[model samples]
Target chain A: MIQLNLHKTLSSTGGKMALDLDLTIEKGHFVTLFGESGAGKTSTLRMLSGLLKPDSGMITVGGTTWFDSRSNIDLKPQQRKVGYVFQDYALFPNMNVRQNLEYALQKNQDNSIIRELLEFAELEELQHRKPETLSGGQKQRVALSRALVQRPEILILDEPLSALDLKMRIKLQEYLLQVHKKYKLTTILVSHDIGEIVKLSDSVFEIQNGRVIKNGTAADFFGLNKTSAKFRFSGEILKIQREDVIYIISVLIGNDIIRVVSDPKEAALLRIGDQVLVASKAFNPIIQKL
Target chain B: MSIVCVEVDNGEELMSVVIDSPESAPYLKKGKKVNVLFKEMEVAVTTQKELNISIENRISGVVASVEMGLLLSRLILETNIGEVIAIISTKSLKQMELVERIEVVIMVKLNEIILAP
Candidate 1:
């Protein structure tokens, strides 16, 4: 299990506050950190990665003690087996897609692993393409491939989908799930979009004013009341289309075609011509993707 | 005469009201109900302005268009206010909730706004 107890303070455009958090995540778990802008999500990630030292606290990953203010032990980021994917899809502009990923395999030098990552990311054809030439979705796939190339014990992703356009975001989300399953790496995702957290995270940690307010499952995170009417109609699965990272599915219900926020699994079940049911108290069906 | 516009998403449509303020512009409450313009183009008490944490409500719409990976979904509204655009993240078709239209009801917290003369 990954246990994190951290407290830090930083001055930013947003107001400042004391950040105190204590979290325990099981192995192979997908945990998402969600909050509004300046909620300290990025700070938490920075502390874990050793890029920023905490004011005071302890951090342990996979039985390894990374930081401890009391014992005065702090490991450099390079020594920690961590794979980080930034929100902007940080790929090398000077290098092609292939070289960008190859650089990540520093000591291991596993060519076969690189090939596997390329195949999994559906980039076999674009391996030689430069980062600038590839589309946003393609670039994200490359970033994901690079992050996993090292096969780090822990994966850190900060708003990985926020930078992509809707369709690319959805496509990359599916690819991310695949990578998560294939590697089973303990992953931590920081996102401001609530829907993204609901769709991708198994567990969600709500951060506010430099503290974790609540930690619960995806359903709980959305406050799904068992008595609510969300299940009144088992909305039919429709045909799913991928633009880039966003998936748009068309469903036929009575005569209305309602679109809801979704992932690849839901999109795949939808057929171009099919019927689906949707039920909600309020008829405001606006999928706001931030 | 003083005028203020208010937008309300009561379950489905995005309704708007433009009416004369009973109090001075300084005393007008943004979220509180006041007189509003009705269909007859006259002032009515049925309308109200919402000043809260988030000004807009959350709703589901149809994926009308997609360009360069950005998907644009059009929401069918029942109000006179018109359409709104929201970005979504995901690719799973099963969770897509593919009905041509879906409705959502969101809670509104109050806020404060000043109309400039």
Candidate 2:
């Protein structure tokens, strides 16, 4: 388990603000820090990673004391076994992919772990490629692989996929899940995207003005209550065509169009340019690949 | 009974039957329209190469996004029928290897469709 009750003062462009956070996270769970800019999400991560010292409070992980203001005990960033993947790829321009990962290894550590990580990250084919030649996704993959070389108990991801496009972001989300499960690591992520937060996190802490304002599961934050049997979307009716006893109705939702079939009696009530919502119940909807 | 026809993307069309009642008369009177609603839990997604089912409402589209919850995953598909959201088991998601832009079919029964003015 990870426990933190930290207080810090941050100086931002707006002014100085106090950041007070208290959180406890179970092991092998994915937790996210969600909020707006300068909401102290990054500050909380920095404090946990030992990059920033807190003004007061205690931080304990799995019975190990990383910080305690009363005793003035603090561990250096290097002393904490944390795997941090920053927003930027942070790959050494001069080093190749394999070398970048090798540099993160502790002295006297076995070199075989590098091979395992390369395979796990699917970077084996690009092992000798330089960071300059790699795509944004590839660079981020390299950064992720390098961070795991130490087999750290805790994994920190700071918007690692923010630079990628939607397609790439989806791909990396899968990889991140694989790595997190394989290592059984306590993962903490910072993100602003609601979809990403819902897809990746087991729990979320909403931060505001450097204080934790709310904590809950993704469903709670997304308001995905399961008791209801109704779904709705608004669209403009585009066309109405007659086919035998049924009328084929067309509606435009955003840039896409949906076709609906209705009885003649019901069709008589609708016309082109009409706005309507198509709702459905909890009946089974089959999904098949094309 | 009132029927509303909707045209989604790719020229595909769908129809919804709106049961006339005092509460729905104003919204369905003649011109005003609003968003569509369906139970979020009623939607299901699959990544199989082919599907054989009796559900009459079948639309094909690329996956727009996937939101994974503890037990369920919310999938948004950009089909010719528009962007439809479905919730499925996480186990099935991993088993089918469903990801963005992968073509899949979404099926909904006709009777379950509700129309809001």
Candidate 3:
């Protein structure tokens, strides 16, 4: 498990915030820190990885104490086996892609693993390409591969896809999703994009004004489903279609068709045009009633 | 049986609701009246706050140019409202229909505005 309970402040000219956070992410779970700009998502990530020292609190990752202010235990960044990927695919300008991955691995580890990571990250063709030569998406892939090459227990990604274009962001998001599934990594991502958080996160922590206001499953937070006390629009069901075991129904609201997923058995009870209600809540993504 | 506009943000055209319920559910056989409820009911104050702030109600502009950068996306939206530039994220660009002379919706939250002394 990765546990962090720390308070830190950033005192830059334009940015200043006192962040007090206490979060525990289960092993192999993807926890996304979501908020607006200056919400302290990046600061929290930096504190966890020992990149920034917290004012006070305990942070233990994978049973190792990364920072414990009371005990005065603060491990160095390199001492913690953490893969940190910044928004800018910070590949060394001096080294090629192969060398980048090579540097990530330990001196005693096999070279074949680097080749495998290159293949998995789909950078096999651009092994010799420098950071400047590769496209934005390609550079992101290389950065992700480089981080994973060391097989770190915890992966800390700070807006990894935020730098890319719209199309590139989606592509890299899917790629990262696949990588997480394959490795079951305990990943922490900081992003302002709600769609990205919805697509990639299992759990979402809503940070506003340097504090976590809400914490819930991604589905609940996005309003995809799971009930909450928020403004909800309930529409009438238009049609129901059967797709294998699932019954998909469309609810009509002012020419808009909202689709809801339900069990086939319950769907069978309703006629071809039975009246069903679709509930969509405010502050959560639109969800069709089950 | 009626849906009324409760709050008007951009010139009464773009707004939210205080709907009593639709006259009828068009597609469904069974329909019932929905009691419109305010999402924020715990507020102490009953009166609404209206402040006189210079807001860009509308903007009429061309794409002018699309500056796609690492952090921010600046869209020079030229409209009859005004040739105002808006900064949005790249992820939000997918949802935007940026065309020449397109009327875009610009929402200004009251909390974001700093009250001058």
**Ten residues in sequence with the least summed lDDT for candidate 2 chain A:** A224-233
Q: Candidate 1 residues A1-290, lDDT tens each? A: 88889988778876567888888988998899988778888888888888999999999988989999999999998888789999888899999998999998868566898899888888999999899998877888899889888778888999888877656666677777777877988889987655556667899999888888988996566654221223323233455667554466665432345666544434566666443434342222356889
CA RMSD of each candidate after superposition: 18.0, 17.1, 19.1
Enumerate the candidates' DockQ scores in order.
0.05, 0.06, 0.01
- Model 3 residue A165 lDDT? 78
What is the C-alpha lDDT profile of model 1 across B74-95, one tens digit per residue? Answer: 2223222334332332232224
* TM-score: the better of candidates 1 and 2: 2
Q: Pick the candidate with the highest TM-score.
A: 2
Kindly list the per-residue Cα lDDT of model 2 for residues B1-117, writing each as its tens digit.
Answer: 545555545766555555453364555544445444444445566555467876656677788987665666778788775767776777788888889888888776555565533
Global lDDT scores for all candidate models: 0.64, 0.79, 0.66
Give the residue spans of candidate 3 off by over 4 A. Answer: A14-16, A226-290, B1-117
TM-score of chain B as predicted in candidate 2: 0.68
- Residue lDDT tens for model 2, A1-290: 99999999999999999998898999999999888899998888899999999999999999999999999889998789899999898999999999999999999999999999999999999999999999999999999999999989999999999999767887899899999999999999998766667778999989999888998897566554321224434566889997533467898754468887654556799989775655444343455899
Model 1, position B88: C-alpha lDDT score: 34
Candidate 3 residue pairs in clash (backbone atoms < 3 Å): A222-A285, B58-B81, B59-B79, B60-B78, B60-B79, B60-B80, B61-B78, B61-B79
DockQ of 1: 0.05
